[model samples]
Target: MANHNDRSGEIVLAEDKAVMAKAAEWLREGRGVALSTVTRTWGSSPRPPGSLMAMNDQGRFIGSVSGGCIEEELIDRYRQGELADTLPLSLGFGVDNQEAGRLGLPCGGRLQITVEHLNSVTSIDQLLNRIDHGELVARQVDLGNGEVRLLTGDGHPELSVSDQSLTKVFGSAWQLLLIGDGQLARYLARMARMLDYRVTICDPRETFTDPDPLPDVDYTRQMPDDAVRNIAARPRTAVVTLAHDPKQDDMALLEALESNAFYIGALGSTRSAAKRHDRLAKMGCSPQQLERIRGPAGVSIGSKRPPEIALSIMAEITATRNRTAGVAAT
Candidate 1:
């Protein structure tokens, strides 16, 4: 496939989400490419560690590890074909403390980039194929000599890895679990679809109804608790209970807290939430697990309507997905 600029580089996250898929597609079409990832960062970094950027042999690139500070430089080097035989290289931009002041970004931040060559055996196509199957894979980068390696980590075996400068490889996919079939849940479900999350909604009441224009979401008419009983939760998964019924919300909350899901929240008022907490406590929930639930869900966006509240909820979920501290719901 010839290099094409899909304008995806303009988006900080679009590139991150699709780079692996795009790289895999290119390699499958007989094109060569390389990937670079920022595995670690310190103090006020532009992108967190694990941020990735990929480039085709023709110098077409997607994704960014910095806020446009280093892509142009990397592109120039890539187009000139300087990295083809460098034996996998880890390059650091921004000079040392004194020189950093001369180059800007002197705010005392560093960017470490690892460049790796792509080939048939190293086909990101295969890697992404595994990811599509829901497995977790890790890419390990040997910093001393730039030897890119791939290994299957514990848990999901269907995950894929593409970056070459990885010192450690871990696999995770964000999950968006909605515990209601109400209009608000439908709205949130649509937004979550755009965010590339696997969405599941559980509603026991047929009267609660199905959303007319639902996105590609998994729907279960089973009782919320029973619907979620078999699914194993992980840190990447988020469970939001919006079903107002205690039986639905309480059961899902209890099960979610017992699992590995990182963001567990419910939709209710302070008084209602307090009551729910007391109920859960009476049901034997510990204080620590109860603390994990964000009742009266969503950040304080001053939203009074369902759509606006949906936006607030999405914002909090996005922050949680990005590992950013969420503003408490007030």
Candidate 2:
């Protein structure tokens, strides 16, 4: 939850993965590690709820729960053994105007943080493995006894803490399915990867050659419709057709519309979009399905260049995803 400045939702999730992985590594090395999480925030706090930070007995740390002095105070307390007896400690900062200024909180911001001492490397390793394998898991920590357990999560609830326990949900990264192979597709794939989306490009044209093959992306020469069907649709999936050719684009769109993809888009001019819609209608697409497709693909940014157009598309996707995730506007 460190300031991401217009990045997509998965970027924050990726940061969470990194911080937890680092904590697991520190514990494996026989070092004492403490994990701190922001349980709640109020009024202009730099970090939001569920933000994480990890510290070692050697004063080494990774991640950020806040932008300023709050982390320093937590580290000092850990090193001084003030938190030794308390297996799980809940602390609040910036409760008053004076305290807010002292803790470097913006305005009269306040934060509730839960700190836990991590002593079992095996347990942390198991949790990290589950996440890496794309499982939706919930980690529950009992404040009274410092007991930790991992349970299958439903993947909808946000992180929450009660007087007795803290519950945090972890899931797989979001996915992007692009039905094209071109300069525009390349740019969009690169940007999407940086935003932490797992990108896959499907194009059946034998003439299509990847100009720059991204390491993380999956490229397939299979037919777009077949590929889309294989990928299926999930709530975290977004499908975009950029091939322009109706044979390919329409085929992919038809399959994508039948799935549960959260966003379905096609790139084209106004006339071209209308023509595509008419063709789909004749092909027996429902009115409800047609309504889900966003013609021209992106926000009206008046961008003519490939990179700018890609940025516009990603911006719109980010906005749509945030709205779906129930994130509040700053």
lDDT of 2 at 124: 76
Instruction: Indicate which candidate wins on lDDT.
Output: 2
How many steric clashes between backbone atoms does each model show?
7, 0
Please give the RMSD to the true structure for each candidate, in Å. Answer: 6.1, 5.2
Please give the TM-score that candidate 1 achieves against the real structure.
0.78
Report every candidate's CA lDDT. Answer: 0.68, 0.81
Clash pairs detected, candidate 1? 130-158, 135-157, 135-158, 135-159, 136-156, 136-159, 141-166
TM-score of 2: 0.82
lDDT of 1 by residue, 186-221 (tens): 888888877777788877775666537475787878
Per-residue CA lDDT of model 2 for 1-330, tens digit only, reads 233221211223327767778788878788899999898888888887878888888877777777765777888889999989657998898746776677556767788899999988887777889988887777889989999999885555447577888887776677899998888988999999988898999988887687768889999888988888877555678889998799999999999889877788898888999999999999999899999998988999887999998998888888777666542212
* Candidate 1 stretches greater than 4 Å from native: 1-17, 24-32, 40-48, 67-69, 94-110, 120-123, 153-172, 324-330
